[model samples]
Target: MSGAFFNSEGISALLQQFDVSKLVELSKKVDLLQVIKNLNSMDDQQLAGLMKVLNAKPKNRELPEIDGDFYDVSHTLTPEQRELQLKVRHFMETEIKPIVNEYWLKDEFPFQIIPKFRELNICGVTYDGYGCPNLPFLMEGVLAMEMARIDSSIATFFGVQSGLSMGSIYICGSEEQKQKWLPQMQKLEKIGAFGLTEPEVGSGAAGGLTTTCKKTDDGWILNGQKKWIGNATFADLIIIWARDLDDNEVKGFIVEKDNPGFAVEKIHGKMALRIVQNGLITLTDCFVTEENRLQNANSFKDTAKVLQMTRAGVAWMATGCARGAYESALDYTRTRKQFGKPIASFQMIQGHLVEMLSNLTAMQTMVFRLSEMQDEGILKDEHASLAKVFCTMRTRDIVSRAREVMGGNGILLEHDVARFVADSEAIYSYEGTKEINSLIVGRSITGFSAFV
Candidate 1:
């Protein structure tokens, strides 16, 4: 025993078995000579027990499945819908996850992924006809959650194409407009943009859209600047919502990207949603044929209908954003060691994770109900607005807590929480701001208008 495990050679081999820093720590805490003396006094049976302890692998350190759906909200979908949800999830996790950080850092859209994205056949997910699946609004909400759960920029890009562009035509454009664009757009051959938020007007778009359209004898002339228009930089066409000069009411038009006087400048210097390719659209007397006018979009009410629907989808996106951040933080805490144990085992860190899950669960459940109301045709502006307000607000909180749990690593993009933290701000403000959405709900509940 003295020569085998207590000699200089045996000690050298034993020290090699342990980590250097850990050995240094252990030496400082315990008397190494005394430990060796005690080890040498142990009998054969005691030595066997010690060897068994040393050879035993740690109780399988694999973490539990990283699911953020605490309430089983996804199980509410049918088997078919659930399958599709997972398909998109797999695609995003495998394809987009690998390249997202690079493109996000460079502020470039990955054109290479577009072909794979088209393979999903999920664009215009809830819209009927023209090669659309015509699934229920609930399924659309789930898909939105799954997309955003990985990255919100891709979700926003999809939302602009599927919800805003196709929805405007499906809800307001003539049948001819639907036939011409929905098929190609659904196939993702022709990308689309939604231009409603303008350089000066966002929350006041309903009442004060400075982008104006004057009806020409042969066509309509659109003139104004649209800010934060997603996909505007490369879209085949953009659904421009401008106030009609003649009627003084908001109207929607399918403004082809190549149409004369249509120019788009890619917006830069963004801190969030960098991969979305948001464009500042300049419609310098841009002309749209009579056929291009969304025939049924005669008033702001029609535009509001599209917003109401997409806003619900935005609420689902908020849940996905929160879930993504929470999952990343949770995974980090489980493996990140501090004080000689996984930080996730600490009470404070566990509390933070629970809080994040609580907010995320609430968000998921709220959007689930919101989408149901939409499918049942009972959705209103206030209902959608209420969801957007609540979900985005909660998402902000979840992401904040997620960042908190990660310590200094929270701000790093490689961990994924930092991206969620920044992208959340953009979601909180777009579609509708928190203050505006709250007022919409307030107006409905209190029987008083709160618009300034």
Candidate 2:
């Protein structure tokens, strides 16, 4: 019976034979008992050796620590903030990084990631009420930076949902709209997309929007094609912006994916942000009820307010892209050997590393303060535009330097830095181009309207 029981469950049954409490007591004195028994028989050397063994403390483990920012911007964070930042980063690396490249290669969004993303529960982070965390905007910026650090495409995908889409509804949508969407969207039960740019209207979208909406007795009839709409392919709802034909002012609509006239085709073979499922959206006489129309979005001015809010987040995202490239390059240089020494030891290589770090640190500090202004209600369009232009422009330089240091390995997608290098171009163009952003700042400082 004992043998049979042991075969089925070895130690569990045997545990009944011994008094665990007594055994634990015996274990505490075993060394002393042996020492007393052997004291008379052993030499001084033997006693000393035994004493050393019994008193020895465990050695501290030396695990390889990951330092993405060599200057340690993490040190600037509060202990709690840093903890949250690390939590999000680990989630991204473990959950998102492994599958991102495969999806990028196939140009397919991973449906599997939705559950993992929901577990994060970070949507509408800085907003109050409506199932939001209401964390500081700095934390929001940190989260964005952390996401982009691993993969910019994922970051952009999230920005479209959280910043552009949800923000529009939050800032402009009616209280009823907020009650209907923000909570479910916050939980990611329904994904959202922002549609602003058109196929022909690239940089001058504000003045050059060709998409138009006509009001009717029934509702509103929308006619337009929206280009480069991230997440539109799978999004449950898209915030479509179009000029009102009667008023000639921009208005926003909650366009459902299942609408009769709505169509989407994936834009493929992109050199940048390919993991993002950008779609060319076509809405021919798409009927949107007045209830679905955003109540507060009266003109281009209302639309611009939402853009102003999200532009700061985009700047932080650009900084994240630069930080990712710099860290990858730093790690490669430190580990990769040349002539039996680490390439990081070379003076020229050191110069590149320093340059990357300088730009990254500048970006980090700038975004930190920018988010602070946003939280304080002091942020302006110029404040957001300056960071966007500076960070994106610097990110291009940082990623290029990162790739150059890796030699041929830089071009290989497996190295991870190459994707960032490519994705920075899209970041540079989207959410207002570098030229457009610079002009925004230029207009603020000189009090001159340069945007044509």
Candidate 3:
């Protein structure tokens, strides 16, 4: 017993104990199935002995597959939506997962993924025309979840391009503007970026935008700096927002990339969403012709409309981040062992896992209904803000627990969960900061603006 069983050739002894004489007699008279049946009839010791004699490893009893969808959200999807969701999920797992870490580490956008993304044909999903799918809001939320599950940077990139940039034109663009931009943007032939947040303005963008656009004889001249403009570096067209000097009201401008006065420097050394190429944009007398203006985006209300739509999408993306972390942690727990037992068996470890799952499930359910309300045309600014605040807050917690349960290994990028942890910070702050979103809800409930 003191010696190592492996070194002494334990199989030979166990085989001897099996009584080979009896097996030869039994096998000669029986079919293979009958022999297996006879083996099944043997006692535990006998069966173990036979296993040793056959030099076969004991069959592993696999635990049931861990599902992060604690609630049956998938059950709610229509067959088509579910198929599309799975398709995006599979693409993320196969195409994005392998190369994501490298690109993420380099803080560079993977331009190559565009062709694969176009193949998905999911761009302009949930939009009405211009070669778009016009799908339900639920499908839109599901697609966001699938993308963030593998890579939040890509999800953010898509949200900026599809949700903010394309959505702005879709919602506020005149017929002509939509006709010009939507189809090409939908096909990813021309990438787009949204520029609203400036260096001096973030959560306070609505009322305080200092970026000014002046009316000129020729058209309008835009002059200001926009911070954290995702995809601005290579976008064919940028949706630039500036307060009109005459009316003191915000307006959206479609600034083409080649505009002489438009300059972009990649905002570097970001801790979160590294795969996103956020640019610090300098607009110096950038002249956009009257035709390029978003004809309907006359005031802050128009800009707010665009933010409201995309903010809900961000909430869904936050849920995706949490779900990805929770599922990754769950998978790791089952396979990772300590003291001859899975670490998942420990009470404290199970507690952390459960907490992560509960938050993730709650976020998933909340976002589902938020999208439902959005589809029904009943979604308000406060409604989207509520989900954004709640889901991003809970996502931060869930990802923390996910990393905590993994101990030191959690911080490593290769573990997969770590990236979610980092990306959650960006999601928490981008569309509306947690504080800004909370104030939106607070103002709605209390009938008072707490922003000041």
Candidate 4:
């Protein structure tokens, strides 16, 4: 054998494969010369097997996917529904994800995405006719979660259109009103906004809506201000709810955006869901013909139906917000090194991750059942309210932990968790607050109204 066979490179490679103590022990062996002779005489196959173990890089134990759907609640979805869920997820990730942060920072709606929404063909998903797919309410809930999982602002925008605006028309509009508005809204040709939350009325809207409408010789004249009206600035239609002056009951009107009596100021300096383009609308005797009135929305109770149907969707949106934050924080912990190892390998980090997953799993299971109830025609006010109260509260916690795990980087928008964290606060306060929703459940369960 040539002396070059045992040169410095060979020795250096051999040292990497063994501990120094083992190498020293082998070096001191009396039969070390015999060991070299044995190596020279070995068969090629034997030497190849011996060299393979020493030369190969350490194999990494593969990690499972960091999916927030830990309990597989979505597994119950039909194959078609699952495919559609993934389709929406892909659209948000590819199209909206790139521009969401920019629009969010600019406090402006991405008008460009509205045309793309037409391509998705999913607006007005739950309504039966007038170009709607009339899919199960469960499908609607899943789609909401899927959209929110990417960006809550987009999800809120969608909920306003599909749930509040379209739902009011679907559940309360006369047949003629439905035929007029739904098909175009379904195609995203006309964006819509729900105007129930007045400047002075939110939870009190059920009884104390100051926005009033009076029967007129010409038409109903609506006068009031609506605050936090999402999509109002650019929406083609705004569904305005006002107290009837003659009857003292709540009624709905489909107000056109360009009405001479209707004006909206874009709300600025918001810290969360900034891309939603929330507006404060002033209606100075906004006149609508009797035909534009939602004929069946006779009182607050009918308007409550619209709210009941949409509040469940808010719970699903909360879950998506939490899911986004949790997944981002989890992936971050797995890759981020601290104290010479991945932070995810630490016990405390794993503990936070598990807690987040546990809360998220609970929220998902609750909404899954909640949607089933809606599809079965059994969903009630307290039923939706309870889920909203619990899920939104837990979402706040989940996002907090998500930010906690990410430390400083969690607050930055590029990491995505910060956006979820900020958007979640809006979800918690909207539709109904924790206190108001709790009172709804409290009134239902104990036969007592705690709401003041």
Candidate 5:
């Protein structure tokens, strides 16, 4: 080796393996000639060690880009919408991807990312007013898919804030309420949670809410425990849904976190969506003023309106989860060897990959049309329910197949498929399970309610 070998290109390639900024700063502080002299004096073994430390690699070789969107569904988006989609994708890959498994393993929320998350400017992407972006419903679905494609827990947290909490305030809130909360919530300055499902009530929340509310001389009194409330542990405000004692109608109330009667206990030992901060919220005579009550939310029907919109988002989430698992499994199969060849080269593995992709594609198209109907103002409850039922059911299959393709690594969290596999179970159950949603569709199509 000669000093001529340490030319600009060689040095540049060597520095590329490390942090460029740190190398630039060090170059500014150190003497280049002395560094080159020290390098020249090193033995062959010492030079090999230095190269190992530098992580030198061959030049001009790049892996083909891997895109999960085989149908090019993203092409339907406008240039601006596509830009937003890629921006969110980059954020998830660069920021959330590295830390997600670690956080999921510890069952802890990454609170430090809140500031970075606010910069995405995607909260309440569909709503028109109150400082929201006022984008189309399709764009909102696209963003949901992008987020969930990386980590379903982060997507769940976003859905709780953007779809459920902000949506309740937007669709059923008074104008004053929207003006007060939507702005701050859209900016993510104030995180919110939706409290509807109780410890005793899951699919029967529509007509069988045990949480009760009563009007008083001071304000309304709420007494109920809300289970599986995402972001509840640290949410600044929680939208508590309770049935009124006077008229037996469901009502929505904005319960502040600092209320004396409100408390939250973290739900631990969750196998799925562990990164999500689910809480068992206890409301013991939680008092809310008349102004805090959602002026338009008079019945469970109004609450159903919020669920109708959010259930569509849930379908998108399930699709993303499937996409994530399928992509991971496909990549693993291509790299993982069996019988002296890539497992992806095997017919059985290819069949599994094709099946996963088929389900994912069907889900993508279904939700795309579902969101289009929503944007057109013709989205019905049954339409949302059908998509939710089909997509989540298919998602369960896709994730399982993904796990099968990965073999033992599918059960490992670091490999990423296991988290999706576990989280798919939760998705299958939440936002109205498959049975409830299927019944909703069945009732609509047959004109007979079988949900007794």
Candidate 6:
């Protein structure tokens, strides 16, 4: 064949071997005339060399797939639940993973992701009505794990909105309250925060909330301060739990963000979960109408119900934090070389990875059962608290070991394990500290209330 014909045939053959879409994309970037002219100018030897190069596919090293669930705990999920779990995992990996480190470093929440997060349609995962998915508590646990696996701050933010805030309405709010707030909050159109913990009372919030509420003809007057409230700085609604001055019992109120007496100052200088926008809220005579009061929340007992449910989620979050750290460290050790071989090949490194995985798997299985109890309507404060204590404590160990395996990189946020390490501290302390949670379980089994 002539040179021009040979060039034309070679180009046509090469195009045929590749995908049509790829060729179309190439056409959009290059001039067809110029490409053909260059092809035609090449000598026969050069043309043959070019053909060989084009035909060769680059060889890439195939790494083994990382599976954190060594015991296949996910097999317990139903097909639909499993599908939802995978969907949430994909959303976390794609949407939250890229920017989480940046946000964590800056100590800022990524408001830009709210609209994208709404697409997940996962808020209020277990509630029965008001536009919630109403899947199951197990599914909610899975979603929490997935979110925390990438970023615990994001998980805490979601938990505040979906679990603590929306849950108060679902479990304690009146029908009308649920009808109004749950739907909007479930859609992420209105953000919400749970204001139960105060500077004076965190683990003791149920019994020792000094933020008082006074009922008047005008409405309920709320006064006092709430500290460490996640999402308070930007939330549209805050579920404030306060002592009803008349009865000396805790009552829940839905306070609007625009309320004149409600002021939120962002809590800064956090060493952990920095991406979560925690606020120190000063509620100075905040007026909430009787209509906004949670009708079912008559006492501290009612408030405890909300904590019982969300504490389960906190356990799941701890599991996810540990899982993220373990997986990141595992991947690092596998590729990180020492003495011309992956450190993962060393006996000590393998032992560290194994210990991390053991704790992680135990946490995963424990939370799975905890959610199962919630789904069965048999979940108790002790059940939730036990998981919280165990998971958080084990998570601390897992993350420290994770950081240990990665050496210097483990302490750096960019590697992802470092964020898990720092965030685990917050998770350990929040919801309920290890000591408090252990006391809860102690009270349950021993019939002695040791909380003072």
Tens digit of per-residue lDDT, candidate 3, span 137-228: 87888899989988899998888878999999999899999999999999999999999999999977879998999999889999999999
Model 1: per-residue Cα lDDT over 1-452, one tens digit each: 53256877888888889999997898999998899988888888888899899999889777789899988988878889989988999999999999999999999999999999999999988877899999999988898989899999999999999999999999998989899989999999999999999888988888999999999889999999999999999999999999999999988999887799999999999999999999999999888999999999988889988888899999999999999999999989999999999999999999999988998888888889999998999998999998899999999999999999998999999999999999999999999889999999999999999888
Model 1 vs. true fold: TM:
0.90
Q: What TM value does model 6 have?
A: 0.86
Model 6: per-residue lDDT, tens digit, 16-118?
8888988789899999778777877788788899999999999986877898999999998989888888998998899889988888899999999999999
User: Per-residue alpha-carbon lDDT of model 4 for 365-420, expressed as tens digits?
Assistant: 99999999999999999999999999999999999999999999999999999999
CA lDDT, candidate 5, residue 104: 94
Where does the lowest 10-residue lDDT sum fall in candidate 4?
Answer: 1-10
Q: What is the TM-score of each predicted model, taking all chains together?
A: 0.90, 0.85, 0.88, 0.88, 0.86, 0.86
Go through the candidates in order and give each one's C-alpha lDDT. Answer: 0.92, 0.88, 0.89, 0.91, 0.92, 0.91
> What TM value does model 2 have?
0.85
In candidate 2 the C-alpha lDDT for residue 339 amounts to 99
Model 2 per-residue lDDT tens digits across residues 1-452? 21233232544565568899986787797873454445645666776787799899999656345465655766768898888888989988998889877877777887888888887878988888899888888888999999999999989888888888999999999999999999999999999999999999977777779999999999999998999999999999999999999988889999999987899999988999888999999999999999999999988889899899899888889998888888888888888998998898899998998898888889988998999999899999999999999999999999999999999999988888999999999999899998888999999999899875
Please provide the root mean square deviation of candidate 5 (C-alpha atoms, Å): 12.5
Model 2 lDDT, full chain set: 0.88
> Model 3: clashing residue pairs?
none
- In candidate 1, stretches whose alpha carbon ends up further than 4 angstroms from where it belongs are 1-29, 32-58
Range of the 10 consecutive residues with the lowest summed lDDT in candidate 6? 1-10
Span of 10 residues, lowest total lDDT, candidate 2:
1-10
Q: Compared to the true structure, candidate 5 yields what TM-score?
A: 0.86
Tell me which of candidates 1 and 5 scores higher on TM-score: 1
